[model samples]
Target: MKAFIVAVVAAIGLAVAAMYALTSNQRFAYQAFATTGARVSEPGTNLVGEKWTGDPNTNDKSESAHGKATGEPSHPKRS
Candidate 1:
């Protein structure tokens, strides 16, 4: 009984650690695009005019263009 309990606890701990790593490792594509200035277009979504911090010159034109075309709302808009 004691060994079974320990095994269960270890399994639970491993599961929790795996969950944390998965969530932390998963990167938001939109956020990445925004940061790198990479033009990312979805079929249904219109994410144009998004302003990013990185190099303006090196940043993709489509991305920057979208940023300019739109109001360039601040990402993760501050309250």
Candidate 2:
């Protein structure tokens, strides 16, 4: 009986987690999970062209501090 109760509790916890992930910002959640710690990139395997460095809409140079070479903003600013 105790095992059954524990199983039910675990199932409920999973359901709640799923619901939260569905309702919350999935991209930021994924980013938080991915980059919350010191991430090591394998040499020659870095995809700088596919990241914010390649994003033309971002002007923030912070990506370099994180190890990326940035370019100009692809989108024009609004007045």
Candidate 3:
């Protein structure tokens, strides 16, 4: 039982030491953080707090795409 406890403690210590060594370098640590941060989450709000943004979308589908050509025209058309 005592040997088992010592082994467990040694493993935890070794793991911590490994982590510290990996993160001790400033350049490598920051590069790892930046690359990891971009891949880990969606591009959403990460701020501390938010206020009432208000209902900005009071009007919906009110704009029209009238006379919009779908395809490229062969002749040069005047705008």
Candidate 4:
């Protein structure tokens, strides 16, 4: 009887896990599994044609900034 009960419990847990995996919500396991979504020029290798320069739209010279380069001041004009 005890063995049968344990088996039933295990089956239920497995079913719940399967349902979770099928959910649309992105989870840690799914994100970590994919290193990069960008297409690769060659299979089994990660090589880029050119290094990323800076955003053309932004005045900031840095490669990455907090927000988009809208060419506008973030703060409002002071009185």
Candidate 5:
């Protein structure tokens, strides 16, 4: 019983560590893209671009206007 409990606890700890690693990796990738002024998006027929600035619509006029008013660029546009 004690061994079973220890194994369960170890499994849970491993799962949490894996989740944290995955999340951190994703965050790092986003940060790298933001720093480089690049975008990442899903491949599709529309082929829409996604800037790494944490916002989704940087090129749309309405979104841009709103972002400017809020003093935050909706997405960092590649210069």
Candidate 6:
């Protein structure tokens, strides 16, 4: 029982250490947002908490076709 407890504690400690090491780097711990304004789940809210207008499905097909015709990569608005 004592051995099992020690093993579990060691595992938890190692996990915590690994997490700390991974997040300690500036690259990993990047703060992209300046303020915590609104939730993205709310209506009209984008990823950056900015007001998003227009329908997401309404992508301009003409622009994509034009790009393709010009030998450029056709960037579709869909994810």
Model 1 CA deviation exceeding 4 Å by range: 33-71, 74-79
Give stretches of model 2 more than 4 Å off.
26-79
The local distance difference test score of each candidate is 0.51, 0.47, 0.40, 0.42, 0.47, 0.40
**In model 2, how large is the Cα lDDT of residue 61?**
33
RMSD of 2: 13.1
Q: What is the C-alpha RMSD of each candidate to the true structure, in Å?
A: 12.8, 13.1, 19.1, 17.0, 8.9, 16.6
Tens digits of per-residue lDDT, candidate 3, 1-79, equal: 9999999999999999999998565332222343532422111111221111333232222244222222332342399
lDDT, residue 10, candidate 3: 100
| Native-structure RMSD, model 1 | 12.8
Superposition TM-score, candidate 4 onto the true structure = 0.30
Report how far residue 72 has shifted in candidate 3, in Å: 46
User: Please, what are the lDDT tens digits per residue for candidate 6 over residues 1-79?
Assistant: 9999999999999999999998665230112322254221322122322112354223233344211112232343496
lDDT of 2 by residue, 3-69 (tens): 9999999999999999999966444222344443433332122443324364434433334533332
For TM-score, candidate 3 versus 4, the one ahead is 3
Q: Model 5 shows how many backbone clashes? A: 0
Clashing pairs in 4: none
For residues 1-79, what per-residue lDDT tens digits would candidate 5 score against the true structure? 9999999999999999999999665543333443334433221111342333444354343454321222233443499
Candidate 5 clashing pairs, residues 3+ apart or interchain: none
Candidate 1 on 1-79: residue-level lDDT in tens? 9999999999999999999999777544454465435545421144432233434443445543432424443344278
Error of 1 at 33 (Å): 4.1
lDDT of predicted model 6: 0.40
TM-score of each: 0.41, 0.31, 0.34, 0.30, 0.38, 0.36
lDDT of candidate 4 at residue 48, scale 0 to 100? 24
Candidate 2 structure, TM-score to reference: 0.31
Candidate 2: residue 56 lDDT (0-100)? 31
